[model samples]
Target: MAWSFWQIQELNKNYDLTIVGAGFTGLHTAIAFKRKYPKASVLIVDQGLGVNAASNRNAGFACFGSPTELLANYQHLGRDAALTMAQKRREGIEFLAHTYGKACDYVPVTSHELFLDAKHDFEHVVSELKLLNADLKSVGFATETFKPSLNAQLEINQIEICGEGQLNPAKLHNALLDNCRAVGIQFCNAKFIDHQLLQDDIAVELEGGMIIKTTALVLATNGFSNTTNIKPARAQVLITEPIYNLQLEGNYHFDKGYYYLRNVGDRVLFGGGRNLDFETETTTDLSLNEFIQSHLENLLRNKLLQNVPFQIAHKWAGIMGIRQDGTPKVEVLGNHIFRIEGMSGMGVALSPVLAQELVELL
Candidate 1:
C-alpha cells in the first residue's frame, strides 16, 4: 500500500514519542508521558482494531496473587522481591479504580484458591497462610489477606480466600482509550514491523511501508514482544450461557493459578489450562487447542458446575508474555527505545503501575 502525500508527510515528521501496542501498558504509558509533557506529540500504534491481546481477553482478575502463587513466588524470587511485586499489584488495582472510576464495573469479592484434594500442596498453602497475610499487611493491606475456608458443596477440601476482586477488561480498555483521546493523544491501528535507533531519534517501520520517526520509543507489546527471552503463552477461555440461579460470585483459581474462573453476572467465564500442553500453548497464535479446551470443559462441568446443565456460549484465546523469573520486564533497550513486556500473566493487575514505572525511566 502506497502512502498518500499527506500521510507520507505525517510519517516523516518526528514525534516526541511513539508507543507500540496500545494495550493496557501502551495506553497508560502514553497517558503518563502526555501528562508530563502536555504539549508533546504522542502517537500510539496497535496492530488490531483494539487491543487484541489479554488486555481485553483476560478473566479480569483484580488480584495480586493467590496463596499458592505467592508461596511459589516467595520461594523462587525470595520474600522481599515477591512482596514488592505484590505491593505493586495492589497499588495498580487502586490506581485503576481511582483513574477509571467505578464505571469499569469493579466488583470486590473474595478470591478463592481451591484445593481439590487434601494433599501436601494444600497442606503447604494452609501452613503458610498466616505468613502470607503478614507479608501482605507489611505492604499496607489493612487486614489479614488469606483465610482458610471449606466448600463441601463443590467437593473441595480447602479454599484459601482473600479480599480480591474483578472488573470488565473490555470496559477498562475502552475507558483508557477514551481518556487518552480526551488528553490529545493520537492512536493509529497499524502493526509495528521493526524499529531502528537513530543517533537522535528512533525510526519505527509499520506494516504498510510507513516509517515513523520519534525522539523516543516505547514497546509495550507485552506478550507480543517477539523478543528472544520473552515467550508468549496462549490462554484459552470460554464463557457459558446464563445459568439459572448461578451461585458462583467471585474469582477462583486452582493448580497454582493455571486455571481461573469467575462469574460474569449469571454466566461463568472460565480460562486457563496451559499447564496441560505447555509446548503447544507457548505460541503467539490466537487459536484454541482442542485438547486444552476439552479439559477446561470437563473441569467446568464436573468440578465447577457440578454437572449442572450449561452450554458454552463463546470461546477465545489470548497470549501472555512470561519471563524466566515470572516477573514483568521493563527496561531500556537502547538510548531512544524503551521496552515493557513479560507481564507473566499478571498484566491485568500489574500494567497500570508498571506503565508508570516505565515512564519514570524516561
Candidate 2:
C-alpha cells in the first residue's frame, strides 16, 4: 500500500512515546518499549512505508565485523573500542536471531573475505588478521584458518573463509514489523521535528504542523539520519537473473569486502565498491551512479562472470550512517528526546543492539 500526505498529516498528532524512523532500529525500539511498558502508548512513525534505509537494502549477512572493518575502525578508534563495538554487533545479531527465528532465512555462512588480487588488498587483510586473531584468541572466539580452494571458481589469490553468513533483508524487516504489531505497537507514516521538553510532557512537532505529546521520543533513523548530524551514506546494489551452474555460494567479500556478492538459490546479488568513489557515493540520495555501476559491471565482465550470458535485473541503493566514531549515536537528545542513528554500514548487526540500549535508556 502507498501513502498520501493527508494520511501522514492525520497521524502527526499526539502520542505517549513517538519513535521516528521505522527502520530496524525504530521497529525494534517500538517492540522493546511495548515490552517494558505494556500499558504505555507506543507509536512508530516514518516518512516511508517502514522500508529500511539499509536494513532492507543490506546484503543480509549476519556478520560480526569483518577483519579489515575492525582494523579500519581500530585505526579511527583504538583496539578496545573497536573490539567492544564488534562485540556489541556480535551480541546484537544473536538477539535478532533469538527474537526472529532462522526461518527469516538467516543463515550463517563463511564470514571472512578473500583478498585474491591487488597486493595492497592482500597486505591489508594480513594486517587485519594479525590484530583480530590476537583479540579473538584472547577470549577463545578465534575462527581463522589458512585454506586454499577453487570453490568460488575464480582465479583469485586467496581463500580465507569461516564464521560469516547471509540472510533475506526484507524478511528481517517484515518479521520485525509483524512482531511489533503482535505486541500492539502502532505505526504511522509521519516525520518529527521541534523537540520541546515541558515540565510534564515532551512536545514533538511534525511536518504537518501538528504536534506529538509523548513522554519520551527516540531516534532510530540509522543511515536516513537527516534529523540531526547523523549522516547516512548511500550504498548501491545490483542483481543478476537466475543463472545455470553458478559457482558463487556463501557470503564472500573481496577488496576488503568493499565488493561483495552471493547467490540466493540461482540468482546472484552483488554490491559494494563505494570505497572506489567515496565523495560521489557519500550522499543520502537513493539513486545510483554511473561510475560505480560501470565499475561493478566491468568487474563482472572481466573478473567474475566473464562472457557469461546474464542480464542485469535490478539496481538500487541503500543508506548507511557514517561518523568519525564507527558507533551508532545512542544518546539522549534532550530531557525527553533520544537519538539512535548512525549504524555505520553495520546497521544490520548493530542497530538491534542499539535498540535494546535505547529501551534501557528510556
Candidate 3:
C-alpha cells in the first residue's frame, strides 16, 4: 500500500520514548514519564482503539491480597519476597485511591475467603490466619488483616480481610487516558509488529506498513507479550441478570483465588475456572471456553446462588500475564529497548508502582 504525503510525514516524526500497549502499565508509565520529563516527546501506541485488554476487562477488585492467596505466596516465594509483594500491592492500592479519588467509583468493602467443605479444611486455614495477619501487619496492613468472618448469613467457614474495596475499571481507564492526554502524551492506534535497534534510536514497525523511530521503547504488552517468561492466562467471566433484593455485596474468593465472585449492584459477577483446563486456558484468545464456562455456571448456581433465581446476563474473557511470583517482570533487552510484563493477574493492583519504577529507570 502506498502512503500519502501527510501519512509519510507523520511516520517521519521521532519520539523520545515510544511505548507499545495502552493498558494500565503503558498509560501509567507514560503519565509518570511525562511528569518527570515534561519536554520529552512521548507517544503511546495501542492495538485496541479504546481501553486495551486486561486493564478494562478485570474484575475491578481493589484488594491487595486475600488470606489464602498470601499464604500460597508465602509457601512459593520466600517470607521476605512474599512480604515485599504484599507491601507493593498495598502501595499500589493506596496510590490508586489517592490518584483517582472517587472518580473511579471505588467503594470500600470487606473481602472474604470461603472455606468449602471437603475442598478446604476449616481448621487448617483458620489456624494459619494468625500467622498471615502477623505477616501482613508488618507490611502496613491492620494487625488483624485476616480474621474469622462474623457474618452469619454466609453459612460457611470463611475469613474476613479488612479494608479492601472494588471499583469501576472502565472509569479508571478513562481517567488514565484523560491524564495522559492532558500531559501532552501522543497516542497512535495500531498493532505493534516488531522493533529494531539502530545506532542511536529504535525503529518500531506497526501494522498497515508504517515504521516509526524513537530514542527508547517500552513493551507493556503483558499477557500479549511474545516473551517466553510471560505466558498468557485467559480468565473467563459471567455475570447474572440483576436479581431483586440481592444480599451479596462484597468481594469474595475461594479455591486459592482461582474462583472469584462479587456483587455488582444486584447482579453477581463470577469468574475463574482456568485451573480446570490450564493447558487450554493458557492462550491469548479472548474467546470463552465452554468447559470452563460450564464449570463457572454450575458453581454459581449450586454453590453460590443456590435456590435464588437469576438469569445469565453476559459472558466474556480477558488474558493475564502469569509468572510464579505474581509480580511484574521488568527487563532491559537493550540500551534503548525495555520490556515490562508478567503481572500474574495482579496488574490492576501492581501497575501504578511498576510505572514509577520504569520512569525512574529511564
Tens-digit lDDT string for candidate 3 (38-140): 9999888888754447987888887777777877878888788888877887888888888885878888788898876666866888888888888788879
lDDT of each: 0.82, 0.72, 0.83
> Model 2: which residue pairs collide?
109-164, 109-165, 110-164, 111-164, 116-157
Model 2 TM-score is: 0.89
Q: TM-scores for all candidates? A: 0.94, 0.89, 0.94
Question: On residues 1-362, what C-alpha lDDT tens digit does candidate 1 reach at each position?
Answer: 11221132244347899998878888889999988889999888878755476788878888888888888788899999999999998998888777774868987788888887656377777788777888799998757778787876696655656657789888888888777878977777688999887877888899989888899999888778888878998999999999999988888988778889999999999999999999999998998999999999999998789958999999999998887667785877888688888887788778888888887887
Candidate 1 achieves a global lDDT of 0.82
Model 3: residues with Cα > 4 Å off, grouped in runs:
1-12, 50-52, 324-326
- Candidate 2, residues 148-203, lDDT tens digits: the string is 34544666555555545677878888788777767867776666656787888888
Which portions of model 1 miss their true places by more than 4 Å?
Answer: 1-12
Q: What clash count goes with each model?
A: 0, 5, 0
lDDT score at residue 173, model 1, on the 0-100 scale: 85
